[model samples]
Target: MEMNRELIVLINARLVGTDPQYHRQIVSHELRENAVWIGAQLHGKDGTATIRTVAALLHVSPSTVSRWFQPGEFERECEYLSHAFKADGSLKPSIPGRGSGTGNDGQ
Candidate 1:
């Protein structure tokens, strides 16, 4: 996957500091967080965002981005569908079921 050069530059610009080491640390953290934010924005109600897409955009490893979607990681901020992402790093169709039904119950 190709990285988004513009986004990378933007993120790096935001991390400019006197300490190069510290800047690198902050950049890594910020990039990971931004990856999650981007994922959430692109995820939509249909889980359209794939891990590889987010990682590629943020210049991070797909596995690293994938970890953020794991249980207890960012569950409160965004819901990650367990079966949504396929092995090929693409999103599968999201089919609503069970609790996803109308609130009126089986009237």
Candidate 2:
């Protein structure tokens, strides 16, 4: 999946209601979540979601996105992504307790 402006705008919308003091933390979390989701989607589609690809999609530095997760977290996310799809090959509507990392994280 290609990164589009709509996705960027939707991600930005999540910041509106966040407390200023915790804004950085929230942004970091969102970036990490999105990176994992996107990475998984790409992987499912037989493509790779590199740090640069995810960073570019999120409009953040590659290092910033990299710092958001441990190796274990990424592996776990990848495992989850492997099962995140339906028989039709589309992702499920939601990612269980974790939202889609768009604007659904309760801000």
Candidate 3:
């Protein structure tokens, strides 16, 4: 599973670098379709990031995040994750009911 995720990242990275705008559009579309491969890629580049951590970062319920990981959940909130973790942090998206947190729980 880990190896597969890494390979997916490598392929996507190449695609992303070659054409960033197109890559984002593809990723967004894949998420909207709830593609399992896209979910795995969103899981984390290293596959070590936890669901709870991802949920907290996105300011959504853990269940919502879990659904994003499912094979077909129509991940409407993926844009938030992509914007928060993948995009440049200069501008932040306003996520409803989530204000803006840096995922810091005073650890």
* Sliding window of 10 residues with minimal summed lDDT for model 3: 82-91
- The stretch of ten residues in a row with the least summed lDDT in candidate 2 is 95-104
Model 2 off-target regions past 4 Å? 1-19, 86-89, 92-107
Pairs with steric clashes in candidate 3 = none
Which segments of model 1 are wrong by more than 4 Å? 1-15, 64-76, 80-107
Winning candidate number (TM-score): 2
CA displacement after TM-score superposition, residue 104 of candidate 3 (Å) = 41
Question: For model 2, how does the per-residue alpha-carbon lDDT over 1-107 read when each residue is reduced to its tens digit?
Answer: 87899877777778464356577777777778888887777666664557778789889898887778775676567557856755444786764447556766644
**For residues 1-107, could you state the per-residue lDDT of candidate 1 as single tens digits?**
87799877777677674468888778777876777666656654455656788789887798877665566465334445424445454666545554646765444
Supply the TM-score for candidate 2.
Answer: 0.56
lDDT values for all models? 0.64, 0.71, 0.50
Ranking by lDDT: 2, 1, 3
Assess the local accuracy of residue 4 in candidate 1 as a C-alpha lDDT between 0 and 100.
Answer: 100
TM-score of each: 0.44, 0.56, 0.25
lDDT at 102, model 3: 69
